[model samples]
Target chain A: MPAPLSRRHLLARGTTAGFFIVAGQWLWLTPREAEARVFDPQVLSPEQCKALSILGDALVPGAADAGIAAYIDLQLQAGDESLLIGKYLGVDTPAQTEFYRAAADNVISLAGDKNSMQTFATNMASDSLSGWAGPPASYVLFVLRADALDVTYGTPEGFERLGIPYMAQIKPDKPW
Target chain B: MVSKNCDVIIVGAGAAGLTLAARLAEGGKSVSILEAGPERKLGDLVSSQIWARKLKWSEPAVSESGNHKIGHAFNAGTGTGGSALHHYGVWLRMHEGDFSLSSDHGVGLDWPLNYEELAPYYDQVQAEIGLSGDSVKERWRPQGAPYPMPPLPLFAQSRVLAKGFAKTGRHTSPLPLAINSEPYQGRPACHYDGWCDSGCSIGALGNPLAVWLPRALAAGALLEHNARVSRVIRDANNTQRVESVEYLQDGERKTMQADRIIVAAFAVQSVRILLSSATEQHSAPGNHSDKLGRYLMTHPAGTIFGLFDEETYPHQGVTAGQLLSHDDYDEKDAAGGFGSSQWMIGHAIKPHDLLGYGTNRPDIFGAELEPWLKRASRHLGNMTVVCEDIPLPENRITLSDRLDRDGIAHAHAHHDLEPSAAARCTQRMSEGADILRAAGASEVWAGPRIGQHHMGGAVMGSNPEESVTDAFGRVHDTDNLYVAGPALFPSSGAVNPTFTITALASRQADHILSIN
Candidate 1:
C-alpha cells in the first residue's frame, strides 16, 4: 500500500515512449496507451477515456503498452459489467458496474476534467488520494492491481517470455 | 422366455471393470464389459488442466440438486476404458495402518483387508500395468515393490515448494506418480509437458489407453459402450444368485445373463443402480445394514495459490501435482485437527487455470480478465490440501423418482462437507500455503473448497449389520451380486483412491474365481 515515490517524483521518473503507430490500426504497446490514445467508444465520453488511461499508467510499469485501456473501454461500452472485478477484489457486493461507475467518477473528480486529466492524476497521487478510502481506492487500486496481475500471471510475458525456466527439482533418473 | 446370455457379463467398465476384463480375456475367459458412456477415442479425452469440465458420465447420467453439488457435470467417465482412459494414474499403495484405521487407532471404520493382505494384490496390479514412481523417498510409503520406473520430474513450482518444506522443518519429496518418467513395460517416457488431466494421448501417462485396457482388448475383451446398466437382475426365488443384468442399449431395453457379475460403475451411480433395481426386485436387501448410500467420501480439496518473484512454469509436467507429504495420512492424526494429507498433488495451473484465479481476488471476468490471465502465466505457484470426507446420510446417491429414457431414474448425488471435514481440509491447506511462502514466492494466497477424488455409498465390511457388502465386496444379502469402484470405500484416506480401487478389484476378482 505504501508506494515508494510520491506523484511528482513518479512523473519526474516516468518515461513515456511515443506510439510507433503502423498503418491505420494504431498499434499499441501498453494497455494504458490503448485507452489514452485509441479505443472505439460509443458509451464512454472522451473525459472518461482520459481518466481510465491516467489511472492505468500508475498501476504498472507499462500497462499502457499492454492495451488494457482499450480492453476495459470495450467492456464498458458493451455493458459487460460482470467482469468479476468485485469477486477478484474480495468484495461480495453485487452490481460491480455501479462500483466501477462510482470509482470512475471519483477518479475523474480527483483527476479533473478533459484537458486537465494528467494534472488531476498527478494531483490525486500527491494530494486527494493520499489517504483515499473505500470505493475510489478500490477502483484505481483494482484496475492497476489487475494490470499488474496480467503482466505477471499467465501470459508468456509473465512466464515463458520472462525467461524463467521450470527448474527440474526431481531427479528423473534410472530406477534402481 | 428365451434367455439372453453372454460368456461373462461384467458391469461398469471404469477402472476396475476394464482392468478385470483385460485380465479375464488374457486368462481365456469370454468376457463382455457393459459401460454407459459414448465411445471416447484418445482424441476425445484430451483436455485442459481441469479435466472434469470436459469429461461427462454418458451412462445413467446424474442430475444433482443441493447447496453443494457433486459438480459431476463431467465427474464420471464413459467410453471403452471407462474412467481409466482419462485417469491420472496416480498409483499409491494404502499404508499397513490404512486397512484397520478404525479398529487399530479408534478412528474411522477399518477396511476388512490389511495392508499385508492387500499388498500382493497391489503388487499384482502395479506389475500388470507397470507403475512408475519412488516409494522409498516417500518415507511413509508402505512396503511394496519399487516402482517399475523412476518418478516424474517436478517442475519449478514443486522444486521451489520442496525447498519451502525443507525450510519449515517439514518434509517434501518428488511425488510417487503413476506416470512414466522413463519407458517401462513398452510404454514411452513422459514428455514432461504437464498435460495429465486431459487424457494422455501419447501413452506416457499410464492411463488405460496406454496400459491395461489395451492388453485386455488384446486378450479378447469386448467393450460395449452406450450400454447403461440399470438393474442387477436375480431370480426372485434364488436372490443370492444373479440371473442377468438389465440395461439400455441402442435406445432399446435389454438384458444380459451371466454365470457371475461385477458392478464397478463408480461410487454414486453404482449405489443408485442397486437401489433402483431393488425398487421391484428385493426390498433393497443391502438396506438391511441401512448403509447403502452412506459413508460417501470425496477428496474434498482445499488449495493455496501464490505468486512468485521467480518464474516457475506452474503449468509444466503432470499438472495434477508432483510433491507430497503423507506423514499425516494415519487415521488417528486425521481424526485429530492435524488432518490426513498428501503432497504429490497440487493443482497444475496455466495462467488462466480457473482454480488459481480464485486464490487471489482480482478481476476475473469482464475487462480485466485477459490481463490477469497473462500475469498468471508466469508468477504463479500453487499447492492443494486433500482430506477424507466423512460419510453422512445426507451426502448420498439415490435414484431420482423421475426416470430417464431407459426407465432408470437419474441418480441424484447429494454431497456436502461435514464441518469436521471442511475444517480438516482448511487446516492442512493453510499449512501447505505456509510451506509455499517459505519457498520464496513473492505472493501467497488460498483457493476455494474443491471436489477432486471421490468415494462411498456401497461400503464393504464384515458385518451385514453395519455395511452393505462383505469383506470381499459381495453384497451381504446377495452372494453372487458384487460391486466395486470407490463405492465400497468405508472412508476415503488423504491418499488418492484409484490404487485402492484397483487393488480391491483384484481382490474381488480372486474371490469371484474361487467361488465359481
Candidate 2:
C-alpha cells in the first residue's frame, strides 16, 4: 500500500488541485491546468466558454489565465451543489446554467466591429449597451465580475498576491 | 413507511431546535430533532468564502418577490447548525420598546410578553453559552445580566472607525458577541482571522454545533438529518392534537409520532411546514384568523464603505464588527423615520465574496481592479446599518405553486419595505457616510439595501385571532403544537435575532417541561 497522506500534505494538495474530468478519467488539477489541458466542459459549450473567458478577462485582468471559464463550468455542472455566487443573488442553481448560457450568448452576439471588448464591458457595467439582450447587462456584469474575483483572488494564493494573510483556522480542501 | 416515537418532536436542528432539544432532553423527556439538511461537523467548516457557500440554503428553493425581497437564499442556511453556523455571532437583545411597537407607537404588532419577562432567559443563555462584551459600555442595553467574558480586543480598524464615531459625537460600545474572548467552557479563544462568515471551525464561536448539539446528544436526544418534514398530521380521533409528523428521508416517506411537537425551522421554513399542515376539516393550526404566514419581517440593512488613509488592516477582527453604536436606538418615532436603528462598525472583511470590496465595486475592472483590491484590503473600513422592519400583514410567506421533485410545494416570500422603514434606512445610510467622512475617510460609498435577519412569519401574541402562536410559542387552536425561533418574534427589531431566538427557545423548553 502507498504511504498514508498526512493532514498537511492533503491540505497542500487540496489548495492547488480541484477535481476535474481529464481524458475520461477523474483527476486532481488546478483550474488553470484544466483550462490549459482543454478539459471537456459538461455544461457550457466551447463557444460559450470562449465568450466567458473573453468577458471575464475583460472584467478582471488575469481571469482567463486563472481559468474563470473552467471554474464556472464546474460550478454549473454541480447543480444544487453549485458554489457560484449567483445563488446568493437570487438565481437558484436550476436557473444558473440558463442564466450563464444566455448571458454568454448575448456577449457573443455583441458585434465586435461595433465596439472593443473594453468598450463593451464599460457599456455592460452601465447597462448602456444598445443591442445587449437577456438578463440585465449590468447585473450580468456584476455576477461575472464577482465570479472572476472568486477565481482570481478568493484563495490562499490569491491572498498572497494581494499581500493579505490567509489566516485560515481550517483551510478549504477544495479552493471552490 | 418507517415510524418512530418520542415524547417531543422538533422540526429543525437549528439554534432554537437544538436549544430546546438539549433542555427538554435534559429534563428527562425523550426528544427527537428532524433536520431538513445533511449532517455537518466542525471539521466540515472550511475557511474559504467560496467553500462556505455549502453552508447556505441550497435545495427546495424559496421563491421571493416584491421590492426589497427577503434575500432568502443569502439569509437562510442548511445543514446541522442551520443559519446559526455561518452567523457572525452578533448577539443582541431586543429593547423594551421593541416589544411594545403596536402598544406604544400605534404601529406594527406587539409581543405577547415584554422585555422583563424574557430578560432572565437572555441572562441564562448568556451564562450557558458565554458572551463577550462590556455591558457597562452598552448603555442602551436593556436590563440584563452582564456578559460572561470580557470584550474581545479591538484592532486597528475598529480604532480608526471609533474615531469617526467620536468625531460625530456618537457613543460606541464593544459589540456583544457569542464568541469567546478567552478560553471559556473548553472552547479556545478566537484567533481573529475574520472567517466568521465562513463558519467557525473552532469551538470559540457559540454556534449550535459548538454549544447545544453535544448537550442534546449526551442527554439522549436523537437527531435525524436530511429529514425534510412535509407536514404535521393531526390525530384522526383527536383533531386538536398534532400526533405525527410526515417527512422524507433517503428517498423514503416516513412518519414519526410524538406527544408534543415544536416547529423550530427558522422563520420561513417553519411557517412553510405549518402552512403545509392545513386540512380540509380545519384551517392550518395557527391560520384560523388567516394570520399564520402573515407579518413577515426582515431588517432593512445596508453597509457603508470608506477608504481610510491609515493602515486599517480590515481583516483583523470578527466579521460581525468590533464596535456598535446604538445612539439612535431608543427614539422610534424620531424625526426622519419610524423605527429604531443601530450601526455595526469596523467589520473584518475580505476582497472577494458578496460583501467584499472587490464585488461591491463593479465599476472598476481589468487593469484597474487588482491594484484597487490590494489597496482596499489594507485601507477599507465598513459598517452596516440595521433598521427595524415594520411588520405588515401583506409581507407574508405563502405556498408557491411550484413543487420540488418530492411533490412538496415550495415556499414563497413577499416583502416590501414600508415607506417609513425605507426612509429610515436611507436616512441612516446617509448619516453613516457622513460619519465616515467625518472620521477622515478619503472616499466613501454605500452598498444597496438588502434584508438581514428574518422574523415574524408565525408571530406570538396575546390574541389567537391576531396572531399564530401564544407567548410560550404554543400554536393557537392546538393543544400540543408550537412554533419556535425567529418565527415567534412579533416585531423585527434592529438588533440581530439569534440571541433572542435562543432565549425564546429556552423559555419554551422550560414551559414545556413544566407542563410535562
Candidate 3:
C-alpha cells in the first residue's frame, strides 16, 4: 500500500476566544501573542497573531501532526470545496462565513461591548447540551460528530488514537 | 457470393460476446453470439441502481415519447453474458401461481406447464450453478428440490429484524440466493463482502460469466463480443428455419448459418431484435399478435431505512441477509397488494449510494446528521418490501423509430404504476416499516417506487397467437429458435426472479441438447 494521503493537507480552523488551546502544534502567526488569531489574514495584524497562536494550540490537543494553523492558513488562501464532512452537507462555506460573522456579533451582543473575545468563549462554552437525536441542531451536531467519526472510524491513526479495536476477519458469521 | 460464413461463432454467453472471441481463436465459430453491448464489469456498476435510465444499454431504444419504452438500454445485458452479467443474484423461485396466472387471476396469460414441470429444471440449475438458502423455511415456496448450498449467516441487524417480525406473528425465512454460502462446485465461498452486484471476482455468486458461460465454452460453445447480431436470417423456402444470423463486427457486415438459434438477449432487446428483423422480407411473423413487446411486468417494491441508537455495521455482510418474510408473498388473491412480494432483511448498504445510503444524509449535515451517522455506523437496519405489479398492457416495450449506429431500431419501454398497484406498494411498505419498527428501529423511512425486478415482454406460454415462445422456452412456429432467461416468464411472482430464470435456462439447454 502506498502511504495514505498526506495529513499535511488537512487540519482545523476555529475562531472565538477564551485562549483557544490547539494543545500540540506549531504556528508562524505574525503577531507575537494574545489577540493574534482573532484577526483575519486579509486584515493581518502582527501583534494580534502572536496571541492567536497560543489560542490555536489550546482548542485541540496534539494539533502538531494535524498542523492546524498552517493547514487553515493554506485553506483560507485557496477556494476548493472544504472537503470537510460539513461541506458535503450542502451547508456551510460562504454561508458559514456570514454565519460566523453573525455569530460573533451575537456573542458581542450577548456579552456587551466591554466583554473581550475571551469572555465570549466562557459564555459560549456554557451552551453545551445533550441528546444527539434532536432535530435542526442535530444536523450541525451530526457534522461535528462526523468529524470525530471521520477521525476515529475512517483513519487507522484515529482508530488507534481512540483505542478502537478492529477485527481482521472477513465474512464473519456474527458481529462482535 | 451471398455471404453465409463468419470468423467466430458464439452461443448464448449470457451476453458475453466480443470479449469471448479474444479468448477463442478470432475467426472460429461458423457463427458467434451477436451481443448488443460491451460486457459490463465492476467499473461499470457505478451508476445509480435505483434509476434504470442511468444504467447501461443500447442508445437507440430510449425515446422522446412512447407508451411502451422498453427500458431496453438499461434492462438487458449488452456484451457477453448479456444482461446476465449485470443482475443482482437473489435467485428465488416463482410460486406455483406464477405459471397458472390465467386460471388463477384471470388477468394475465398462463404457462402450458406449472411449477412442478419446472421443478426438476430448478434442481438441475441449482446443481450446475450453486444457489444458497434454506428452502424449508419458505412455507409458500413451491415444491422443488432443496437448495444445494446453505444460507449465508445473518448479522445483528437481520436477527433483530427477525425478532420484530416474530413479535408481530409474521414469518421471515432465508432468501434463496444465487450467492454461495459454503463453497461448492469449483468456486470458493462468498467472502460476504457485499460486492455481488459489481460482478463477483470470486465465483461464489452465480453469474453466467462465471458459471454457465464457462461450462458452455467447455462444451465447445463459441462466444462473440462486439459482434452485434443485427437480425436473425430466415431461408425463403421455409421462413421458420433460422438459417443464419446477420451481425456487425468492427463495422464490417458479417453472417453465419447455424443449425439452431436462441434469442437470449433479455426481454426488451429480444423483442427489439425481432422488430428490427421485420424488415421488408421477414416482416410477417415478427409482430403477428402485436404482443411481441407487450405485457411488461416488474415487481414495484418499497424500501425502508431505519436509524437507531447504535451502529448497524451495514458493511459487514452480504447485500441481503439470508432471511425473507413471505407473509405477503403469495397474496395474489390478497386485496391489499397488487401482487405478492416478500420482505428481505438487513442487506449491506453503501455510504454514497443515491438512495438509503449514509452519504444521502448530507442534508441533515449540521449537528443533526452527526448522531444518525454515528448511529448508522453501527445501528442502521433496513428491509425491502417487494410486491408484484399486475401485467399492464400499457407497460410494454416497442421499437423506437430511431435506429442504432447499424440502422437497427432500439426498443422503447413504457412502464408506469397503476393507482391500485401503487396503493399495494404503499400498504406493503407500511407493513414492512411496521416490521422494522417492531424489530426496534428508533427512526424509519421507506422509499419512492423503483424499477421493480425486471420481467415481461417476449413472454413464453402455450399458444403461438398470444405469446412469443412455447413452454420449455421454445419460440413458437419456429424450430431451433429457442428463447431462454426471465423473458419467458408469463407471470412474475413478487420474489427475486433470477432463480426461475436459471431454471428455465437449464430447461431450455436440456431441450436444446435433447433436440440436437
Candidate that scores best on DockQ: 2
* Candidates ranked by lDDT: 2, 1, 3
Interface RMSD of each: 12.4, 0.7, 12.2
- Separate DockQ for every predicted complex: 0.05, 0.78, 0.03
Give, for candidate 2 chain B, the lowest lDDT window spanning 10 residues.
B1-10
In model 1, state the lDDT of residue A104.
59
Top candidate by lDDT: 2
In candidate 3 chain B, what residue range of length 10 has the lowest lDDT sum? Answer: B46-55
Q: Is the docking of candidate 3 incorrect, acceptable, medium or high quality?
A: incorrect
TM-score, candidate 2, is 0.97
Candidate 2 residue runs with Cα over 4 Å from true position: A1-28, A111-115, B1-4
Alpha carbon lDDT at B311, candidate 3: 51
Writing each residue's lDDT as its tens digit, candidate 1 over B221-283 gives: 788887888887777668776778888888788888877677888887788878877755366
What are the models' TM-scores?
A: 0.73, 0.97, 0.70
Residue-wise C-alpha lDDT for candidate 2, range A1-176, written one tens digit per residue? 22333457646674565666666656566677778767667799878888998889888888888899999998887889899999998898889999999988988898363237888888887888888778999999999999999988998888999999999998775577
Per-residue lDDT tens digits for candidate 3, residues B369-404, read 435454565777878877776676677777777666
